[model samples]
Target: MPELRTERLLLRAWQPADLAPWAAMNADPEVRRYFPEVLTREQSEASVARFQADLDERGWGWWAVEVRATGEFIGFTGLDPVDEDMPFTGVEAGWRLTRSAWGHGYATEAARAALTFGFTTLGLPEIVAVTTATNLRSQAVMRRLGMACDPADDFDDPDVPDGPLRRCVVYRISAGTALS
Candidate 1:
């Protein structure tokens, strides 16, 4: 797996040391607020295992992000293949960070590196981002990454239960677009 570096972060493959913190982050109510539920330690570990396996097989997936200065495991930010059942199927840029990492623009910074890898290294034509309409925090990061939104692209996420979170907005950026 490739390791991505930014001014203050290292987006790399998962390490054994990351398991405990990763689970704790998943269990954080604030961190998992946009999701349907907070994950149990077992569920979080399963997710970590899945992400690690995907990275091993594909050479790219959600990466474990660490703060370079302090060597703290913050969270993950990277690309994922959108599910086939969605109205649009393609690679999506996504991120999740602990509350302590929230206000420092780390998500945008790490995600920019991920987008570069997606467009240049992976030769992807375009990448999309999706979030619940109410997830303004994530949407702001998407815009900061130079992704444009199209209201027509909005759709109800079938995988989410019928609720506010099911109504999702989609944003996209082409491979060569200038990122802010």
Candidate 2:
């Protein structure tokens, strides 16, 4: 898989060493707050395996994000195919970081790299991001990346069981609208 470098983070292929930390990130209630539930270690490991497979086959997917200077596995940031069951169809940009990695602009920086790749190298016309409507943290990151939300795009996620998280907002940025 191709590796992406920013000012500090490296978006690269998942390594065996990243597994434990990735699992921890998945299991953290705070980190998983926007999702339905925290993941088990086995589920986390399976996610890494799937991420690696996507990277190996497509040359891009959710990447293990590491701090360049310290080589610490903080989390993941990259492009993913929007869930097939969603009302929309397109690539999506996403990020998840360890609590320690929050508030450092890492998500924005790393996600910018991912969006750049989707718009330029992959030639995708547009990329979208979805999060629970109440997930202001991620919504803020989307805004930082110059993505805009159309109220009309909001919808109840078909895949989510009944809960607060079912209502989601979709933020979109076309190639022409993406930041340089």
Candidate 3:
């Protein structure tokens, strides 16, 4: 996909040279706290490769986010389809950033752009966001984006081991009301 530029970030595809920084971000315990595990260098490279391929084939994937002024990559954000049997079938918006980029409204900005792409360019009616129950920061971002929590729509994430974090919370926003 083409690069998306925000006031402070450039969201674009990953390059091979991004492996080291991507791996370092993955290795940061704080950054990986919500994920099951920190990805190794090889895994990071593979992930980036897959993301690149997905963008090439589908025209949408998690694009790398970089600082606009310095061109320093910070992390990624994009739209992803939830697996089959998910409560919602449409695309879902998501994001992740390095510790250095946290609390700067970058996640909200990048995610808004992704959601716009999903609802406008992709013509999706609604987009959902799922995260561990304990991931309050992400949940808060969803709310800030005008998504509503559907307590009745909670689900157990088979990908995550059974635990508090495994019981996922879902947030949703329709294209008509995303900016409300």
Model 3: weakest 10-residue lDDT segment is 83-92
Residue pairs in clash, model 1: none
RMSD of each: 1.1, 0.8, 1.3
lDDT, candidate 3, equals: 0.87
Compute each candidate's TM-score over C-alphas. 0.97, 0.98, 0.95
Question: Lowest summed-lDDT stretch of 10 residues in model 1?
Answer: 171-180
Clashing pairs in 2: none
Considering every candidate listed, which one attains the maximal lDDT?
A: 2
Model 1, runs deviating above 4 Å: none
Candidate 3 lDDT tens digits, 1-180: 678888888889887667778989998989988878888888888889888988998989889988899888899999887888665687788988899999999999999989888887888889999888889999999998889998998888887876676788899999899745
Which window of ten consecutive residues has the lowest lDDT sum in model 2?
171-180
TM-score of candidate 1 against the unseen true structure: 0.97
lDDT per residue as tens, model 2, 1-180: 689999898999999999999999999999999999999999999999999999999999999999999999999999999888889999999999999999999999999999999988999999999899999999999999999999999999988998899999999999998845
- Provide backbone clash counts, one per model: 0, 0, 0
Winner of 2 and 3 under lDDT: 2
TM-score-better candidate, 2 vs 3:
2
